[model samples]
Target: MVEQNFTKVKEFILLGFTADLQLQRVLFLIFLIIYVFCLLGNITMIFLICADSRLHTPMYFFIGNLSFLYLWYSSLFAPKILMICITDDKSISFAGCLAQFFFAAGLDLSECYLLAAMAYDCYVAITNALLYSQAMPLRLCASLVAASYFGGFLNSTIMISKTFTLSFCDNNVIDDFFCDLPLLVKLACDVKENYQAVVCFIMASNVFTPTILILASYLFIIAAILNICSIQGHLKVFSTCGSHLTAVTLYYGSILFIYSRSSSSYALEWDKVVSVFYTVVTSVLNPLLYSLRNKDVKDALKKMLDRAKVS
Candidate 1:
């Protein structure tokens, strides 16, 4: 196969979710509502965590950072999705596509490691309750969060560099709303077998490393809970982890489902549906997951409202 050098290509045409004008209008409205809710919800979560001195612990610190991550994460896709749906101009510059892919990769990658860090924090709290404060000191917590961001962006930088270097043909139409690796790979004129292997290795490391850490952390957590004599004590201890567990399942489940299949087996329609779960739905639900399921957050919210009424 003669490789077409499309290095001169200036832009990509994104084939968004639907072509029908009515459906596009409806999608526009739906995404607009969801985006607004995501912003407000994450902002509220971050505010509550920062405002309440009670939420200064390691768990809340991670939750606050997760909220911050979602703010940027959701923002990265929502505007582009909105523009693609609401207008006929579906073109994105090559540089813009790369930028979108970079940030989205960085943020989600950060989230995976951050979630692992949160799982470990939970483990320490349950296994070493007496020493949790000592184990998860503020400086250590900050360092973990810093490492997550740094590692995420570094991985993203490598991913984009390898991906964008592939020569794309003049057919620059991306089949999805976003600039995902799979979609970009499909557009490349000549993707080496080794390159695919390398990409797979990087992605697996990014996902599985944290997944293994989480499962290990939870295994120990469950063991600790089993050793407790009273049933009430077991439930009490497990309740604290309920929110983080839910967040992890929702985030990781959607991600694994989308990426687990070979690219040849992908159903773009289903992929779009699953993509919405991680990109939009998970973000919107994260704040509710933490605030609604948490007693401390509820109490903090109550006190804040009471203070508002007084003022």
Candidate 2:
């Protein structure tokens, strides 16, 4: 009977935002708009960075990589979300659900490392301005970016193997919009306390490790900024790192709130709302945050427009 039950869950039902047709329609429209804006914003950022040679620096390189990540990251869930909202078909195959979780976890983990790399880049630029070019050479930048991606996906593979190997007997309904790890863990049959502890530890490590690196990099950055004597220098330094700090805060804040809890203690409704913020809302906000607040990006856009007009 136990083995039979474990094999019965061929698919899982996702209880998305609402059951009401009217509300789902409204959400569909809203998510569609958000998805479109996310794509356009990231695409524009990527294009501007690529077209303008003047904007090609370590900072913009990281920024471009971020936009690139957003493009694929947001794409992973948004379309499926749109389909769910519109068709009211929340059924996901067992394999499909695992695939979604694997990709989502990998990309989100990658972003954490990428943000840390960006923070380090900022620290290097401020602390060693004279040697900025030499310090952040193309080869080194490439290696850091490569490591971020590799580390993220590698960790995801471990997580997926551990999580999915458990027997998800009988219960096939996920309480959140996505195949969130905690909710899936709740579905496992006869899960031991030690197993749960191990899962939570792994998840926390994924979040906290990058967070510590980011905070450490900023500590050095702050120390470097304090040496600047002028008030204008302080503001300039703050402005330079402000966008990145905001992004980090948003990403880490939501992740900590969601992942730092015992799986049994999750407020499912609240998790859904916060998930939307980091997963959907952040994608749209990042391009604007990094581009609009940036003088070089603004200049690049202006120059591109001017060139178009002349041609």
Q: Estimate, for each residue in 5-38, the C-alpha lDDT of model 1 and write its tens digit.
A: 4576789998889999999999999999999999
Each candidate's number of clashing pairs is 0, 0
Q: Give, for candidate 2, the lowest lDDT window spanning 10 residues.
A: 1-10
How accurate locally is residue 47 in candidate 1, as Cα lDDT from 0 to 100? Answer: 88
The TM-score values for the models, in the order shown, are 0.95, 0.94
Q: Model 2 over residues 1-311: C-alpha lDDT tens digits?
A: 34333446889998888899999999999999999999999999999988889878988899999999988988888988888889958999999999999999999989989999999998998888789989999888888899999989998998887777778778998876788887887788866676678766766787788889999999998898878999998887887899999999899889888877777768467878888888888999999999889888989888888999999
Cα displacement (angstroms), candidate 2, residue 102, comes to 0.5
Candidate 2 displacement at residue 74 in angstroms: 0.9
Candidate 1 TM-score to native:
0.95
C-alpha lDDT of residue 162 in model 2: 77
> lDDT score of model 1?
0.89
Superposed Cα deviation of residue 49, candidate 2 (Å) = 1.1
- Model 2: per-residue Cα lDDT at residue 153: 95
lDDT of each: 0.89, 0.87
